[model samples]
Every structure is written in C-alpha cells, then in structure tokens.
Target: MAALIEMREIVKIYPNGVVANDGVNFSVDRGEIHALVGENGAGKSTLMKILYGMERPTGGEILLDGQPVHFHSSNDAIAAGVGMVHQNFMLVPSFTVAENIVLGQEPLRNGLLDQAEALRVTRELSQQYGLRVEPEAVVDSINVGMRQRVEILKTLYRGAQVLILDEPTAVLTPQETQELFAAVRKLVDQGKTVIFITHKLREVKEISNRVTVMRSGKVMGVVQTEDATRESLARMMVGRDVFLQVNKPPVTRGKKVLEVHNLSYVSETGRTMLHNVSFNVYGGEVLGIAGVEGNGQTELAETLSGLRPAATGTASVNGKAILNTNPRTVRLSGVAHIPEDRLTNGLALTASIDENLIVDRYFRPPFHRGLFIDYKVVEKQSADLIQEYGIRTPNGKLPVKSLSGGNMQKVIVAREFTSDPALLIAAQPTRGIDVGATEFVRDQLVKQRTDGKAVLLISADLSEVMSLSDRIIVMYEGEITGVFPDAASVSEEELGLYMLGIKRQTKEEMEAVL
Candidate 1:
C-alpha cells in the first residue's frame, strides 16, 4: 500500500549555518501510529514543522496521496488535511470548549457566531472520536486531558486526516495518558493517521506501530515497534548505551534543611493557588511534590524560591527566613533552584554561556576583581562545567539561545548543582529533554541527595517522582491531599487518586508525617 505522506531528501539549514534536517526521507502510512523519536536537536521537530508548514525546508520534496504539495503556512497545511497540536496548548481559557474548537471556522447564521451549531459540531466530533469533552465547560475549568481532547477535536473539525501530536502526554497523568492512547487508537481505526513525537521510549513501544529514530540532524534508524527494545532505540538516539534506571545509594537523613509551615499563595488574579501547604526537606533526602501541572506546584516552587510572595505562612532555609525575600537572598541562604521554565527564569538567552554560568556569583570572590571582571577565570570555569555537564556546545562563548533545549537545560543544571547549596529545588528538571539528558539530570539530583544535601523535587512525570523521591506529597487544588512517607510503597494509580482529589488523607494524617 502507498503511504499517506512522504518526504524525500529533505534538507533545512538555518541562516546561522545550522543543519537542522539533512537529507531526511520520512513516510507515514495510512491509519498507522508512526512515532518520531530523537534526542534534543535531533531534527525530528524541524522535520515535523516543515510538514505542518510552520517552517520551510531549504530543500525537499513532499508528497501526499502520491501528489506533490507545498505548504506556505499552517493554514495551507490545515487545508491539505494536516494539523499539529503543539506542546503548549493553544486554547483561550475564557472561551468554552465548543468555542475554542470552532474558533477560526465558526458556524455562520446571519453572519453571527452560531453558538448552537458550534456546540453541536463539538459534541458530534467528541462522540465520533471517543474523545469526550463537555461543550459547555469553560476551557479554564476543564482538566488537562479534556483540554487535549478539545484540541484534537478542533483539528478533526477542520478535516485533519493526518494529525501530529507533539509530546502529547508530557503533562498527563497515567490514566489520562491511557485515555489519550485509546482515543488515538480509535482515530487510527477510523482512518486517521497520527505522527507521534516524544522522548519517552516506553510510550513509543506501547503506542506506535513503527518508530523512526533521529540524531544529529539525520535519520539514525527506523524499525518496527515490536522488533525494537527501549535500550536499542535509546542507543540509536544518543549513539551509546544509555542507562534507563537510576542507581541511588542509600543515605542517612540528617538535619532539617528546609521548613515550610502553613504556606499559602494567592495569584495576581486573586485566585488562591497554594493553601496551608507544609513540608520539610532534610539533608540527605529528596522530598518530591507530585501533582498535575497548575495545581499549585508552580506557585509553591516559586514562593519557596522567593520568585513569588506568599500570602500567608513561613518558609525558612537553615533557620533563616527565606519567603518573600529576594531570589538572591534565597540563594545566599543556601538554596539553589532549577526553575521549571528554563527559558523564562533560568538563563539569559542572549548572553554567552560563560556569562550565564556566573550570574549568581559574578560579584563575589575571584571573578570580582577590584575594577574589572576576570574573564579568564570565568571562561575557564565555564569551559570546565561545559565539559563536566556534557553540554553540546563547541565553546562557552556562544549565546545560550544558540543551543538546543537539552543543552540549555544542562547549562542550568551545571550552575545550580555546582552552587553547593544546603537545599536544592529541582522543578521539572528533566522535562522536554531526551532520555540521555534525562538520565544525566536524574543522576545529578540523586547525587545531591546522596551527598547530604536536601533536595526538593517537583515533576509532572509520575514515574520520575516515584523513583527519585524519598517521600512524596500529593497536591490537589492548592492543598495537600495525601502524603506518603515511603515513595516506593505507593503506586502511580494511588498517587493519581490524590492528585485528582479522588482520595484524600485527613489533615492530621498528613501532619503526622510532615
């Protein structure tokens, strides 16, 4: 059978002479779940962007249904029955799901937005695809899984026979992920072709019929899913055997490094985000905050890191009050934070890697000369850290924006991990990074714990939280729903229950452990 989509000899080179995609030949069969797996900067995204018309290939030939096609914009791709759902959702929060679904192509009645017709179309598509969503619910009030279904229905409403899902399950619970997988299977059974892009090898093995691996701007290998092992695919991605499991040695818990009591935060919009949250991280142990994204996890991390002010309560690091203080003061109080949004809070994108590496301590000690900054010391330190952290850059002189997502994360990890803090707050530290980089980051976090440093971990990846956390706390709607003293004893499903507020421990029960 002929493939539904095909790209031949595709090549894309940026103005900076970076070869994003080199001679790439890719094809997706009709009604098949084709997974595109690769490390960061492996060219998978570039290839998909070209297909979705977000980017133009420097050189390539694309064929759909055995006919040549060129897409100048996303509208062109949508017209050609191709649609993409980006990692970040593109829905308007204030609008209803139905309105968001039929946003651009609203049903017309007397030149007005036919609301009844929009809801009808949304319900029809939702039922047809088994992607259940409430037509009347505001987008802001819906869960992440439902919002994702709305996104998919939006594409299907536009006649997308070929769908591209980019990191679709990156923020979903295990149950939600399974629901999405079921919906995808239904779509495939109904003659829709899906191109799945993710760094998760387990999902690749479970969901895809075939997998294509890419590395260094080129296709490394393509193989049947049943015929490939996770280890094999990971090896192909990074050109070496990657350790999928973390080996953390047992450590003796010591002094309390961080203490939070009745911490509460209200957003700028006056919505309560964190409510009476309390936790303690002791030296030589990892305390993990596990929850669905936006359930006060970001607010909690930001408040504790001094990025945001707390409405009530207290947080102290090593017997010193840190809450509501400046980030620099928090750092000086022996707290190092790896912010969840690296591009926004972590790095100076336009600055050289050397400059970013020394931002926290550029004014202290050796780098701070009497009348001038010591570039020699800064350059040497940056070079050493670049090698030590395995950041894929030729030199430290290049702007941080020039590196890939994983490399940029490595820059943050290098700086934060080397700060010699008593407490480390790692928020989604390995998110959006490939398996190789994820393994590296996980190891570093574990190292901090084993070295007698208190580590506070917040991650949407449930498996990661279970594996790396010594103690786990589940949050729901800005409150602590449950606390597990032994992370290994609890299952992801159990954790998910607390995460969704389906199960809850009494406040006294949680306080006993806390």
Candidate 2:
C-alpha cells in the first residue's frame, strides 16, 4: 500500500542547539496502526509535532498521499485531516461532554450554538464508536478512561482521517487498556490511520501492525511487529543488552520497621476515605499496595508518610509512633518517602540541584554546623549523590527545572535513598519515566530490600507489582480486599475483580494471609 504520510531527511534543530530530529526519515502506511517507540528526549514527539505542523522542521519535505504539502500551523494540518491527542487531556473541566466535543466547531443556528444538533451528533458518535459517554455529563465528573475516549471523539468529530495518540495507555488500568486497544482496532477497521507514540514495547507488540524505533533523534529502523521482539527493539534503541526480567532475590523478613494500625480518615465533608486500614512492613520486604487509582491509595501513602494527618489511627516507624508528625519528625524517626507527584511535592524546581539534594538533610550536623550551613560539605555531598544516582546533568549547580522528568525523579530517589532509613515509602516511584529509567529504579528498590530496609510500594501498574512485591495487598473502596503472599500467583484479572469491588474476600480468608 502507498504511504499516507512520508518525510524525507527531517532535521529539526532548536535555538538552544538541541537537535530534536536529525536526518530522520519516517512514513506511515494508510489505515494502519503504526507505533513510534523510543526513550524520553529521543525526538518522537518532535517528529509528531513536525507532522502536525506544531513545529516546522529546519530541513525536510513532507509528502501526503503522494502530493507535496506544507502546513503552516496546526489548523492547516487539521484542515488536511490530521489531529493529535496529547498525553494530557485538553478539556474544559466545567464543560459538558457534548460541549467539549464540539468546542471550536460548534454548530450554529442564527448566530447561536445549535445545542440540540451538538447533543445529537455527540450521541451518534458515541454510539457509533462504542464510547458510551453521557453527552450532558461534566468532563471532571468522568473517569480518566472515559475522558480519554472524549478526547479521541473530539478528533473524530473534527473529521480527521489520521489520529495521533501520545502515550494513551499510561494512565489506564489493565481493563481500560484492553478497551482502548479495542477502540484503536475499531478506528483502524473504519479506515483511520493511527500513529501511536509510546515507550512501552509491550503495547507496541500488542496493538501495532508495524514499529518504528528511534534513538538520539534518528530513525534506527522500522520492522513488522510480528518479526520484532522487545529484546530486539531495546537493543536497537539503547545499543545494549536489556534485562527484561527483574531479578528480585529472596528476602529475609526482619523486625517490623513500619506499622499502620486501624487508620481511619474522614474528609471535610464527613465522608470516610480510609476505613480502619492496617498493615505491617518488615525490614527487607516490599509490601505492594495494589488498587485502581483513587481507591484511597494516595491517601494511604500520604497518611503513612506523615504528609496527611490521620483522623484516627497510629503509624509507627521502628516502634516509634509518628502519627500527625511533620515530615522532619518522620524523617528523624527513620522514614523515607518518594511522593507520588514528583513535580509538586518531590522537588523544588526553582532551586539548584545541589540545594534540592540537601533540602531534607540541610539542618543536620554534617550539612550544618551550629547555626550555619557548611557550603563545602553540602556541595561535596550533593555532587557525590548526583553521580551515585546516575542523574544526567551537567553539574549540581544547575537548577532542577532544567533536568528532564526522569532525571528529576532520579534526584528525588537519590535524596530519599541516601538517607538509608529503616522504612521506605515509595509511591509510584517509576511513574512517567522511560523504561530504562524504570528498570533502574526497580533495581534500586530491590537493592534496598537486599540491604534489609522495609519498602512500602504503592503502584497502579499491575506488572510492576507482580514482578517486584513480596506481598500484595489489594485495596477496593478504601478497604483491603485481599492479601496475597506471592504476587506471581495471582492474575491481573483476579486483581482487577478485587480492585473494582466486583469481588470481596472474607475476614477469615484475609486473616490467613495477613
């Protein structure tokens, strides 16, 4: 089949001397699910932006359907039947689904929007695509998966013949991911071309007809999906052997390092969030908390880490009750926390890397003497931590904001792990990072286990939980549904059943494991 879109020798150079795309040649076949996979900062986004006319390439010629074309802006690209759905959903939270669907191109009657027409069209599209969205429901009221469907529908409503989805499954549950794959297949069956950009090789193998691998702003190769393996793709992208399996050695359970007893928290509106949640983590074991997002996972992590005040409960670190304790006191009590939202809670973006490295330990004796901080000591320690953590930065003096998301996460990991606490609370430690970085982070966590430190790992990724945890606690509706001794013994479907509250375990069954 002829290519629908083709670019020859695409080169994009930023004003900061960053070569986003260098002599890159790419093409997508008509009516096929083509995947683009690479590490972060590998120029996949830049190539897509160039195709969508969000960025103009410094050197290249683009051919669409065998005809040379130039798109000055995204509007031009959209007029040419191209649309992109960003990783972050672009929807007005207060607007209804129908309103968001027909936002920029609302039907008009006598200079006023035709609300009835809009609703009818949205319903028709929803029915045709099996989106199952309520036209009148507010965007904020819907779940993440439904919101993603609305975003896809917005592009379909624009009459796009080609759709670009950037990391569509990043925030979805396993069930939701299957549904999304079904939707993608349906779109392709209806003759819509798709460009899927992701770093996950498994998704590429599952959903894509062909794969294009990029590395350091260049196209490494393109291959048939069936002929390609994750190992092959990793080798092509990183130029090295990649260990696909996590080697978590046997852990020896030691003394209880952290314990949460009868934790209960009520919201400001008198609604219960966590209901008598209790768990224990021993030194040298990773206690994995598994749940669908927003099933009190964030609240549990925050409460245990002393970031949120528990209404009623006791959280102890190394036999010391630390409930309602400030972060400083929690740290002093031998607790280290890797918060979920790295940008908001983990790092001071405006501060220098060196300053962020020592923010949690600056007041201690080695960092500070008497009433003054020792600058030389701080600098030396920060420099060592940066190198030890493998944080990719020019120097520790640079601002944290200048680093990429993965490197910034590394800085947070470095600071928390350097403390060498008795208990480690890792909440979504590898969230939003590339696969390479994720592997590194998981190894570090396993190393912590080897060092006999207790780790409380809260994650939405089922595979990570199954591969890394010694014990799995499934939560549903803010309650522990089931506790399993080995994560490998349980299937994701079984876990999903518990996570969605479709199944429950008896107290006797839970007690046998707990």
Most TM-score-accurate candidate: 1
> How far out, in Å, is residue 451 in model 1?
0.3
Q: Clashes in candidate 1: how many?
A: 0
Give the Cα-based TM-score of candidate 2 against the true structure: 0.94
The local distance difference test score of each candidate is 0.94, 0.89
Which ten residues in a row are the worst by lDDT in model 1?
A: 493-502
**Per-residue lDDT tens digits of candidate 2, residues 192-297?**
9999998778889999999999988999999999999999998887777788789998878899888888898777768788999888999999999988777788
lDDT of 1 by residue, 1-514 (tens): 8889999999999998989999999999999999999998899999999999999999989999999999999999999999999889999999999999999999999999999999999999988999999999999998888888999999999999999999999889888899999999999999999999998889999999999999989999889999999999999999999999889899999999899999999999999999999889999999999999989999999999989999999999999999999999999999999999999999999999999999999998799999888999999999999999999888999999988899999999999999999999999999999888999999999999999999999999999999999999999999999999999899998898888888999988988989
Against the hidden reference, what TM-scores do the models get?
Answer: 0.98, 0.94
- Model 1: lDDT equals 0.94
Q: How accurate is candidate 2 locally (lDDT)?
A: 0.89
Name the regions of candidate 2 deviating beyond 4 angstroms: 108-115, 266-272
Off by over 4 Å in 1: none
